[model samples]
Target: MPNKLVIYIHSGEPTQFSFAIVNGQNQLQNIHHHHDLLPQESFEEIIVIVPTEDILLTSVALPKMSRNRYQSALPFALEEQVIDDVEHLHFTAFDYQPDGQLPVAIVAHEKMAIWLQALDALSLKPTQMLPSVFALPYNEGQLQIIVESNILVRTGRWAGFASDRINFSQFLHALPVGSAPQEIEVLNFSDTSLAASQDSLFTYHEKFAASADFFPTLVQHALNSPGNLLQGPYAMKKTTLWRGDKLLKISLCLGVALFSLLFLYPTVSYFILKPKLTALNAGIKRIYQKQFPKSTAIVAPKLRLEEKLKKLAGGGDKGGLNQILSHLGQAMQTESNVKLKRFDFQNGQATIELTADSSEDFSTFTSALTNQGMLVKQQSANLVGTKINATIQVS
Candidate 1:
């Protein structure tokens, strides 16, 4: 008795669907035609009405048996009534009548899978499903029929068929004489014109305009009917804490985000920092050029500066000529007899020509240079009349 959604599937097409919302009071709240399956509201239960031609509403009488035995023998018992192999069809058996006739619904397994898959795509699962013919109002001793896009004829409480409007008479007359109704009433839901019965096979015939509340009316009858095709393997599975469809969508979105981060981070970082690196390199080049203005081939300015300093200091330190002069002055402070004659520098080495008061003074000056961590090599030496003259290399 809770609010429910009733979906009418047309022409075996998942996209061609219509639905109605019935409240707990059994009143029609909304109706939509050719509607998308996305529902804006919630319902306690959902019932689906499929095209009748796709469902085989028939009955079979069987000996009393346990539920398992009845289910196992159902397919073979109805095998002769269907054209397709029993293995390829799905069967749903209902309670037995007084005469032991079990009302049954049969549909192809492939068709059932397709319908369920379509509903699953929309995240919908219907609790009850039956043929559209059952939606017609039923009366005792009278046949009820409805005409819309197709013709639906309900001859008994649980018997009916859906056919094209053009073939209505052919199928109607094909019914067994003993089983045909004494009176027939037709509810026409379309603009199509209906002609009175001329065959005179029935005692009375009546055609009436379909009411504005047709969807709600049909939904009420369907809910009261005892036919549901969702049984055995076709029943809706219980939903887990997390729905499969929502979980899959979430996982796919996360995968896309991770891929974007991995693919774009390095490229974005390079573009963002490229300008800063360029500015720093430019500043270093300008400072190197300003300090050594006369130098033109400026390859590796830092290394070029180190080479210039080495030439000035004869490979000792970055203080250049000043450091070399400081060391020489200290070495000679204790050797007053040693006098500087000439000084020359080339290729990271310095040559000094010196005069000393005696050989001992010259020896003492060279030893002092060696003790100061400078490589001293005496290139030439001569004993003059009263003085010692020597040319030495220091680096």
Candidate 2:
């Protein structure tokens, strides 16, 4: 569990602030009175409670619409109720009521800018910024009022208003008959008691003692309240994880892959390819021994074979068609999957079509012919149904 710091800014005074630190268990750890200085203590969450007078709490009726459309249409919906132009106000909508009306908080764009700038100067980023009137505890069927320098009222779960103390009576009269709460509970924090009212709006009026520590109690109530004004552009950026358990897991996977390539891959390749290499060398030795039966010590089979072929060709550049054909057949004897499809001899070149099980077999056959001093020109190689069909011209 993490501790949270709640800071409440005094109305009309940006420099003077009161703050409280609440532990994870909702117990008050410390409280500070009006201080011009900001606290240097770190907390997991910081909540800023701004003056309610700067925020207007009202409900607007809106039909079902997309989220983006709802946001764009909100200011126009309550345009007539506000004296300022719609573009100058920042509106944040809360949850819907049972009566199908959406509660919204409206404040001037300039006021929001000022509050953010103040917090920025103090290096305090609030996770949740709310209107202070919402800090008053709300009860069903009752209007909770806190009488301090101003009258803060909480009428519903998401409904509230701040009014001047001298105009509290007029504000009550302005509300429609059925709209007023059934009962009124006042928590007087001021040095003087609330003035008695003769209006019928105060029929079920009652008074309760204010919390011993007013600002901290205000923060405690706000800890559970839902609405936060930091929506859309004002929202706090979430932290990203560059190093953690997830990254460690990824690093371990890469290490295993590297180990497989460096240690396991070559070992597996040696076992698979060793037999093929040995067979090729033995085939070359057999061909060399067949040509030079009386001669021994076949040091380089490919070079010796080429020398013998050149001597048989009268040391000319072109081997005869018969010799070329015979040499091609002997060279391809080791490649079991390679087959001679067709052949056409013209001038001194033999144009032969061959088919092999794979491109690798074709490459081996071509490499062997080229090493034996044959001028092999591969014209085309195409794959057809699990076989490589190729054409080669040799002289």
Candidate 3:
């Protein structure tokens, strides 16, 4: 077992709490550090003990089934004796014994929320919680004790009784006679635990003041308690050695995906479209040969198609696309670095878009076209990244 810090939470008013840090080795780890803690103080790896009066501890003979199914049905089993709605409380059971019955502890949801919230403020999340009354050092019989003005008694392994001193006798009287402990042992015998009317039946003895180390004893008993309240919704998160590694791997995969989208998309598209581009070029040559059987050389399919359209236009006037292409193809001779990116013609108009060293080169080309008696208009254009992109319209 690891060293654990135990917290004993008291009831009412200003909310007092006690704590102790105990290590694993009984002989090597005898250092019992105990202290009272402020609500804002930080602690961790803890077990918490709540005053018994705040929790109803009992046992129910649950049906033999998976733990989840059993837990789901527990509220109904406890419905009759508890006056409030089951939804208002949190029910947690002890570790399952092969037997069907299990010890259960029930506390109000509001009360538990308050306790957990206080602990949360201090960054202390406890791994376990049990009723403080169970820390009374009880055996397989009756045990009675007094802490301050309260009477605490253990009637069974997973059963207990605790109430104000004023109500102890009446509480005891209300119990069925045969249901009393086979034997009752008293610790820290005081007026609250044994009234003149109540003590004669039980025996008591203490070599030293066991009450001096009340906080430490409570911490010990909390560590040794049979049941835990951190169950169901409040169970601690289960962590594994590889969780961080797994998270890093997922983050890396997502980062790779994002980087690929931003920088690698064009390369991926090139590979995907390269084969289709070749197939389309082959299909275009085949169609061109089918139309012009005499032409064995298929140097440029687009130029041949434009030549065919120009011949089909009767070759009388070089006033439209033919004039534009003729002049631009001549420009291509003088400016060897200039390349045509797109050539589109429609509705008695044609537009040429190209990339060049700078806008000045495109302006020189447009001036040259204007000098060639071609009606040319430089359209909207802009620089794209490292390249200068310009468009010109011819009609």
Clashes of each: 0, 0, 0
Per-residue error (Å), model 3, residue 8: 0.9
lDDT at residue 304 of model 1 (Cα atoms): 78
Best by lDDT: 2
Q: In candidate 1, what are the lDDT values of residues 226-320, reduced to their tens digit?
A: 67788888776654534787788899999999999998998899998999999998898787787677767568887877886665666447334
Q: Residue pairs in steric clash, candidate 3?
A: none
lDDT of 3 at 145: 57
User: How does residue 116 of candidate 3 score in lDDT?
Assistant: 87
| Candidate 3 displacement at residue 82 in angstroms | 0.8
Q: What is the TM-score of each candidate against the true structure?
A: 0.56, 0.59, 0.53
Model 3, residue 336: distance off in Å is 70
lDDT of the structure predicted as candidate 1: 0.78
Clashing pairs for model 2 are none
Over 167-263, each residue of candidate 3 has an lDDT whose tens digit, in order, gives: 8767766666766654544454333334444545533442223454556656666666766777898887643435787888999999999998988
lDDT (0 to 1) per candidate: 0.78, 0.81, 0.69
